[model samples]
Target: MLMALSAPALAHPHSFIDMQTTLVMQQKNLLALKMVWTMDEITSADLLYDAGSAGAGSEIWKKLAAEVMARVMAQHYFTNVYRDGKPLRYMRLPSEYQLSRNGNKAVLEFVIPLAQPAPLAGKPIIFSTYDPSYFVDMTYKSDRALHLPAEATPACALSLFTPKPNASMQAYALSLDKADAPPEEMDLGQQFAQKVTLQCQ
Candidate 1:
């Protein structure tokens, strides 16, 4: 049963990403989150090679971008925002989105708005990024990856939490195959996710 249960959790995470996120605020209210993701060299190389084969400035890039965005949308942009321990819903798709390449790396940028903007004057909030299926590992570039507005900086403090998976968990994650579908009851990726918290005065 353990092996059967772990089967689905073990299949996935074929890609890696380094992510940077900014908390957008308006008049002390949380408005949206701006995200920048840079894909690893091998994946980036594959994408660029494909793009080149399709021809420069070809429509294939556009189609690829659309497909990528569609997959991300299906996963709620791989984001989870919370206030007081309750999850916050997304109002809609990103206001702005683009896919591009910087040398050998593929980059993705977008902004996701909250369903209902929350006041940041007196409370705290948390956000995290992870692929539920564990098919992609999303990691912050550094401690400075989470940015806050100038005004919010005075009253708000930012903290990052990177979960360290134990040896057993690591082995379990390593056992997963890229083609495996995640089990509905298991959120294996979350166990190894990085979280950003904004605490306000």
Candidate 2:
């Protein structure tokens, strides 16, 4: 463990989230992605503390969800989608969104509608989500984390690919402080995020 820590590659992630993604399909076509991000107890401590007095399904939860979602929107949802290496577009606002608590964790759920649904029966689609600066580590809990529409599963296959950052990239991520913002073009988050690929043929 010590040796691995001392290795040239280190990210020093400050916060962690267990993520799940659902591919919403219609007639074998991709429509939107339903995302759920569950923050660890320690990371959600402040939010939970603030909501300590608020009851479930109260306006407080709704208000907090909007506030957090606004930030997410400002960051392009901290997400990227592509088809055959070309970037895909998404609606500026999600059709549905909310924040809720489960047990000891805070959960964020949202659905990002595609500007135009793609035909999955024709090609593969790929996507990834992460914090560009590496301050927050976003990871899928497992292959099961990616839920597929039942109608499309028979003809589709899904896989999650966790990337291994090269030495230089790892060093750069580890050297940075939380206050620093990565350059937009670098797509620093992409280097460390787990990528999901969906194919239908």
Candidate 3:
């Protein structure tokens, strides 16, 4: 639900997000995650236009932010955490969240708390974030875009695993025009999302 725009002149991924993530640690447990998304200029422009004359932190701005947050919530925050092969749960609402501007771009920052902090020394922890429709391509610039709590490092580390969409998958994505959406059952975006694997030494 990120956008309902004009037919794309190109394939899927009409929008993009430059993301940075932090693994929040409490003692030896994974407590939460801090996510920062810097949106592309084109997407930022549309968002700003919707904001109108709303000043920073004003009621109007807050309302606008809430609307956007609602979209993210509806999509389950576009995030997932897993241990072994099973999914981990998150709090219904982020412990903290905000939508604002950074120069000509839009920035969203949020802290997603785990329902129950999982210990770092056990099963492998895999995490990923992506838009299911694959209308937007979310990426991390590099491993540098991922971080560990100062207290968690050395003992704990994260490795990014890039996605490799097969030729048919690529073609399917290319076939989607702006208005066309894949079936909900496809879970297309996750197929293209970069995954992070966490392990404590």
Best by TM-score: 3
lDDT value, candidate 1, whole model: 0.76
Candidate 2, pairs of clashing residues: none
lDDT of 1 by residue, 1-201 (tens): 111112123344667788999888998788999999888776676567666755434587776666667777877888889888899888668887777777777777889998888888655788999876666778996778889888888988889988888998887877767465557577888888888988887
For model 2, the superposed segments whose C-alpha errors exceed 4 Å read: 1-11, 179-186
- Can you give the TM-score per candidate against the true fold? 0.85, 0.87, 0.91
RMSD (CA, Å), each prediction: 5.1, 5.8, 2.0
Cα lDDT tens digits, model 3, 46-120, are 777777767788776677677777778788888989999999999989898888888877888889899999999
Candidate 1 displacement at residue 127 in angstroms: 0.8
The TM-score ranking, best first, is 3, 2, 1
lDDT of 2: 0.81
Model 3 alpha-carbon drift over 4 Å, by segment: 4-9, 52-55
Q: Which candidate is the best by lDDT?
A: 3
lDDT of 1 at 196: 91
